[model samples]
Target: MSPLLDTLSNAVGAAHVLTHDDPGADLSAWEQDWRQRARGRALAVVRPGSTAEVAAVVRACAAAGVSIVPQGGNTGLVVGSVPDGSGTQVVLSLTRMNKVRAIDAANLTITVDAGCVLQAVQDAAEQAGFLFPLSLAAEGSCTIGGNLATNAGGTQVLRYGNARELCLGLEVVTAQGEVWHGLSGLRKDNTGYDLRDLFVGSEGTLGVITAATMKLYPLPAAQLTAWAAVPSLDAAVQLLGLAHQHLGAGLTGFEVMGQFALSLVAKHFPQQRVPLWDEHPYCVLLENSDNESEEHARAQFERLLETAFENGVVSDAVVAENLQQAHALWHIRESIPLAQAEEGLNIKHDISIPVSKIPAFCAETDALLQHEVPGVRLVNFGHLGDGNLHYNVQAPEGGDAKAFLRTMEERVNTLVFDAVARYDGSISAEHGVGSLKVDKLPGYKDPVALGLMRAVKQALDPHNTLNPGRVLSA
Candidate 1:
């Protein structure tokens, strides 16, 4: 063990090699997950400044028969990026490799180190007169490597697509410490096999993503936002249809929030001034990105809202008058999860159903959950345009939240996941199957599909050298 640590220290300067043995060295940031769901112990935390250093670390760990957990911002909710409690795995941190390698304006692509923050990429594109539409609430701290690893679908998935669709190429290090330089920003390439797709959403089980070349879009001329009060989830779905018909490709975002969810935001963060939540069962946030002009975008939004109101789909609505107002509206939408945390500990589900079946799914699941666990408060909200919902559950009012979770977490998950299967939906939509959902996947996921996944995992990481016990069991 000492020799291996010495080898790692030599490969990437000793200063970058942090260990639990060091006095006053705290590894909680890299050991714990974003949700605080599980904290693991790591033998060493290695921060490599370059791809070559990462490769060297991998080679040394492989020779020493040690598992490596590749980590980025440590903002993953599923506990995928952190190490286990064995205290033997190496935590490979990529934050030191932060750099925007190149921006090919002509090709509409930007190549960046895996450690680049998502917001930094977006800002770079904006500065270069382009748009990077992959956005999430955690963009401020989440790295592009983690985003692509989970195939993150954010607010703009309705128009731009998920992280998998936005990426053009990747630079990965195999389990054998070989680098695959696949960062060719070509839109069309008839390659033999699409290795890029294989690793994009692999969750680091297959390889380590060091850098990526992602697609970019032209900046919209005007982006207008609207907040609408809907009578029900069904009406919210109807409003979504109207938005697509009116805005078409310009419909960049359509988020749905339950009244209870909004109330939590208002109750926890009073300064947000959540609108249209008191009188309605749900409120929807819409975004229209137009290339023509703000006037045109406003007109389209107005027409959409007018038709929705006429069709009895909307009770009330308000369109942002300026950029500041638009950002304020978006801020409220992104603050739901944080507000939920502030309220108390809760169970979260990031499930996705077909657009047409979401209403029925929610109605049935809501009834089923209430019947199973009386007085359980539901915090339902997510990207309705893309059919993904963050259908979370809170404990009964004034009860012990921790005790409720300890006793009911398993039951609640089973009830919700069973309903998701009935609706032909996935148990996980945006978040990957980390250790939290790894065991549950076997029961819900198809046997044949699961077998294929295990086969791939064995082929790529036979030694289980990369992210052992994640996505697939070690």
Candidate 2:
């Protein structure tokens, strides 16, 4: 252990290798997840400044027979990036390798280090007169590496696609400390196996993502946002179909929020002024990005809403007059998770059902949950355009929230995940199968699919040297 630590210290400066042995050294930021759901004890937190340094650290850990957990931003909801309590695993932190390697405007691609923040990448692209559209609430702190590792889907995924689709290439450090310099801006390459796709969503189990070349799009001439009051979940689904029909490729974002979910925001964050949530069972946030003028975008949104009203899918609606208003509306939608936290401890499930079957699935699942746990509250909201729902469960009013979570989390997860399986939906939509949901995969995932995944893991990292006990058991 001492020799390995010495080697790591030599590879990436002694200051980069953090350990409890260093006086006044605090590793809490690297140890605990943002949600506070997990806190790990790492043997050491190794910050590598370059891909070469990452490979060196991986080699050192592999030679010592010590497992490594690759982390970026430390903003992940699942306990995938943190080390276990054993205090024997090395945490390979990528935040130090933050850099924008290249931006080929003609090629419409932006290559960046895995440690580069998502927001920074967006800003870089914007500065160069382009748009990098992978966005979520955690963009401020989340890293591109982590985003690709999880194959994250955000608000713009309806038109732009997930991180995997946006990514054209990846620079990964294999488990054996070898560098795969596959980064490129090429859009078409039928040369062989798609290794980039394999590592994009592998969640650090297969290899360490050092950097990536992500797709970019031209900045829209006009971007308009609207919030509509929906009578029910079915109405929301109808409105979504209408949006696709009317807005066509112009539609970039379509988010659905249940009335209860908005109510939580109203109760916890009174300043944001939630709209039309009191009278409707659901409300949707829609975005239209047009290549034409702002007036054209506004007109398209108006036509969509008018049709929605005539069809009785939307009872009321409000379109943002400016960028500030648009951001405010988005802020309210993003505040759901925080508001839930302010209210109390809750069980969160990231699941996806076919767009057409969402309403029915929610109806059945809601009833089953209410019957099973009387008075349990459901917080439902997510990117409806992509069919992903952050269908979270909250404890009943005026009860021990912590106690509810302690005793009922497993039961609730089973109930929700079982329903997801019945609907032919995935239990994990954008959130990868971290240590939290690793065990749940067997029952929900197809036997053949699970076997194939296991085979891939064995083939990629046979000794489980990278992120062991993550997507699969060791």
Candidate 3:
């Protein structure tokens, strides 16, 4: 046996280590990303059961000068969790360590192993009469480690914040195979470095996050959801201002969808039938949650909508009659991405701009795209409340989509990213700079910030043994 393989087998047992010969060893699901953009060969896929085991595996890899790619559920969109083309890198899968370490309902905190599925964590918190608000459509399959690695943002980010905000502490295994136990439920800790923050969004480049302690909130007593048709993106932003004035932070969700985006959902899922038939230029899916009763929440939402209508911000609106109806509305919003994917051959750009700049950004960018890439189909939608938009572009019908993408994908990306830059916004909104965006990081990211990132990476993983060529390229 190879010395490195022998050492890994000794560290985490032989059964947990799978080589190329094992059945399902290189299953496309694990080997490839969600978008099928990255698929790489690995020396072996290792499953370590505990922090100590992870540390030992890391130490062995470090000693052998082998790169380790920490993988969770492999649901990442940025090609972060998969191995590189090198046949020497090891795939460290955390699936075996899935467990709920602790749930302190009294403290409004739940400590869990990093491998636990996000939905499982939410279920545990709900079972304890609390709510873990880090939600995403991939919650059923995406692991907490992957979510923390990317600092995922979902529907609730408008209120509860993203993964970085929802997390209180983390137990990280650094590059040298040393475990740093910073998992505490304390709300306020004025520590020197705030190491927890560093590993949360490090994308497995700085360290391997073994476990985390996350904050929870009281389950909402009553929740309200609305599907409103707005005259334009400008009106949607204005309605958002009215919503803030009326509902304030009670507005837990404020999502926007363009006509084509919603139409795709309806077209893909004909069984659901389009809820609102109005062909408005834009739509806003807003959710309001409260500790008060259902009636109170409903009344508050009605007041906000009424005021919005009076001000001509909202063209039309509908309040979900029941929980099933609310889910139906949200399902439509969540289904847009899948619907787009099902349709095929589209370039997705997840960028963010200031809330105020969204209307102009959309108008200018849309105009530019139409002008430059003539006959381009645009699907514009995302968390407008939080300023992140999934600005995706599709080829004109019957125009050799793949060839168009091949010729124009880079140019489209340049246009979107340049617009993002022009508005002083981020090229990447919620997703981190995984291997997918490593090259683009140099141009859009500030040089000093990039330098500091490299410095920290050097300090943490001097050998570049953990997830090399990921977030901050070596």
Candidate 4:
């Protein structure tokens, strides 16, 4: 047996380590990203069952001068969790540490092992009569550790905030084989440096997050979802302002989609009929939740819609009558990416700007794209309330998707990112700066900020053995 393999086996047991030639060592999910754009070769895949085991495994790799890639769930979009093409890296899988240590209802927090799936955590919270609000479409497969590592933001981020905000404390295995047991579930810790926040979005470059304490909220009594067709993006922005004035915190979610994007969904999913038959150029999906009663929630939404229609900001509307209908409405919003994928491969962008600037940004960007990349199709929608958009582009119909990406992808990205910088926006909003965006970071990110990131990386993982070439390339 190889010395490194023997050491890993001794640390966590032989059954948990899988060499490339071992059974089920295809490394399909662990080595490749969700988009299948980034693939790598790994020496072996090791599963450690506890923080101690993880620390030991990390130590062994450090001593052997072998690099390590810490991975969980493997559902990340930016290829952040996957290793590079190099075959010398060892992947430390956290699936075996799937355990829920404690759920303190009185304190409104649940401390769980990093490998526990997001859906399981949410279910646990619901069963305990609370709500774990950090939700995503991949909740069934994505792990809390991966979510925190990426600082993921989903539909609920508009209200409950991102993974970083929901996380209270973390248990991490640092690069030098030391465990930082900062798992105190205190709401306020004023003692020192915010190491917890630093590691939350380090993308495993700093350390391996073993477990976390997550905040929970009281379950809402009712939720109302609506599909509204707007006259224009500007009109949608006006409606958003009205919602804030009228609904306040009760406005849980606000999403916007262009005509082309909505058409793609309806075309691919025949059963998900569009809300209204109209030549509307824009559509808005809004959700309002009430902690009191269904009647109260419905009344508020109806009043808001009434005002919107009276102002002629909304051209048409449909309110979901029940939970099943609400889910169906959301299904249309969630199915855009799937429909686009079925259509063909496209270049994807996750961007964020000020809520007030979103309308102007969209208008200017749409015109810019049309002029520069004529006939290219745009599939766009996003959390309008939080200023994040999944703005993607596909080759013109009857054109080659692959060839278009090859020739125009980088140029298109430059165009979009340059505009984003002009508008004071972020290049990566929800999806992180994984291997996909590593090269793009230096140009967009401030030089001093990049230097500080390097300093933090050096201090935490001095050997640069963990997730090499990820957020900040070595």
**Every model's TM-score:** 0.99, 0.99, 0.98, 0.98
lDDT of each: 0.94, 0.94, 0.89, 0.90
lDDT of 3 by residue, 1-474 (tens): 799999999999999888887766655556788888778888888999999999999999999999999999998878898888777989999988889999887888999999999999999999989988887789899999999999999998999999999999999999999989889999899858788888878899989999999999999998889999999999999998988888877899999999988888888888777665447988999998888889888889989999998999998899998999999888888899899987788998889899999999989999999999888889999999999999999888778878987899889999989989999999888877788888889889999999999999999988899998887766
Q: In candidate 1, what are the lDDT values of residues 81-163, reduced to their tens digit?
A: 99999999999999988899999999999999999999999999999999999999999999999999999999999998999
Quality of model 2 by C-alpha lDDT: 0.94
Per-residue alpha-carbon lDDT of candidate 4 for residues 1-474, written as tens digits (9 for 90 to 100): 789999999999998888787855677768888888878888888999999999999999999999998998998888888777777899999988888899998999999999999999999999999999987778899999999999999888878999999999999999998999988899998999999999998999999999999999999999899999999878988999888877888888899988888888888888888776348888998989889899999899889999999999999898999999999988888888888888899999999989888888888998999999889888888888899999898899999889998999999999889888999999999888988899999989999999999999998888898998899976
Query: Distance (Å) between predicted and true CA of 430, model 2?
Result: 0.5
- lDDT of candidate 3 at residue 217, scale 0 to 100: 94
- RMSD each, Å: 0.8, 0.8, 1.1, 1.2
Enumerate residue pairs that collide in model 4: none
Q: By the TM-score metric, which is better: model 1 or model 3?
A: 1
